[model samples]
Target: MITLTLVGIGSGNPEHLTLQAVRALNDADLILIPEKGKAKDELAQVRREICANVLTSDVHIQGFDLPIRNEAITDYDARVNDWHDRIAVIWKQQIDAHLPDGGKVAFLVWGDPSLYDSTLRIADRIQANMPLDVKVIPGITSIQTLTAAHAIPVNTINGPFVVTTGRRLRDEGLPAGIENVIVMLDGECSFTGLNPDGLHIYWTAYAGMEGEINLSGPLSEITDEIIATRKAAREDRGWVMDIYMLVRSTP
Candidate 1:
């Protein structure tokens, strides 16, 4: 049986590793790291650094090229499904090659797997083809890190909140009967399309990591500032991981 462990490493900081995650890293037979590209080399490096910083036992660590999603696929779900299939195949290939006898392999996931991450879903594809035992070690999510960085409670007392993606935020305005909403995967800064009145936004780039940027205030007052800051950071680093929380300022 192949033991697959998905360990959440938290936002880009090496210090984000929990004791459980450290133990899982040191216990793995093989650790797979995704090599996105030259532009996101640091993401892979951060994974390596986590191992370097916390791993005590010698573990086989390998870097694999991540399959880039085909934008030409047109259908969003289809494109994502195809991309995941490719990744699962790559993972299976790596496991077969390295662990002919069936041993434990681990992946370092950013934030908790239960959140917007697709790691768990991709792992299901591998399970379809093999006898697999999966274990998930939860770590701090970007949402938690974002709120912690801002030193604000995630929701008002006795109130409910919703978490969504930028696409939904743009397509469907804010959810009804909710005062707080979180957009986790927003490359487009969907808030720009919304009416800023009575909306307060707390946005941060690279939360819990170096070069962190925080911008918060009346959405109307700092919408342009957040956009410019996001653009500048992306240009400087070739990539940016960000999240923002929008609260209805009035009622």
Candidate 2:
């Protein structure tokens, strides 16, 4: 039986790694790190650095080139589903090649697996071909870092918050009566599409990393600033991972 442990390493901060995550890293027979090409090679490097820092045992570490999503497909769902399928095939090949006998293998995930990440779904696809036992070790999310960096509560005393993607926010405006909205996986500045009046935005890029940048203020006042800052940061770094929270000014 293959024991697949998905360990969340949290944001870019090594200190964000939990005790359980550290233990899981040392306990794994093999760890798979995905290479996201030259543009995002630093991402794979972070995982390698994490492993080097905490791993006390002789755990085998392998880096596999990740499959790029075919942006040519106009259908969003079809494009993403096809991408996940291809990733699963690549995962299976790596696992089979490394662990022919089926031992414990771990994949270091960014943030909690239960969040927007699709590692769990890709693992599910791998299950169709092998006997696998999956485990998740939750770690800090970018949302947590974003909030903590801005020193704000995610929600009001008795209010609820909706966590969603950029595309969804752009397609459908903020949910009615939901004052708190957390946006992720947004490459575009979708918040600019919303009614800036009576809204506040706390935005952060590379939330917990060394080059972290933060902007927070009335949406109307800082929309352009955030967009320009975000653009320049991405251009300088070659890649950027960001998240933001939008809070209605009134109760």
TM-score of each: 0.97, 0.97
Candidate 1 regions with alpha-carbon error over 4 angstroms: none
Model 1 agreement with the true structure over 119-187: per-residue lDDT tens digits? 999999999999999999999999999999989888999999999999999999899999999998899
Question: Model 1 — which ten-residue stretch has the worst lDDT?
Answer: 34-43
Steric collisions counted per model: 0, 0
lDDT of each: 0.92, 0.92
Cα error, residue 193 of model 2, in Å, equals: 1.2
**Where does the lowest 10-residue lDDT sum fall in candidate 2?**
35-44
* Error in Å for residue 100 of model 2: 0.5
lDDT of 2 by residue, 103-197 (tens): 99999998889999999999999999899999999989999999999999999889899999999999999999998999999998898888888
Candidate 1 residue 222 Cα shift, in angstroms, is: 0.2
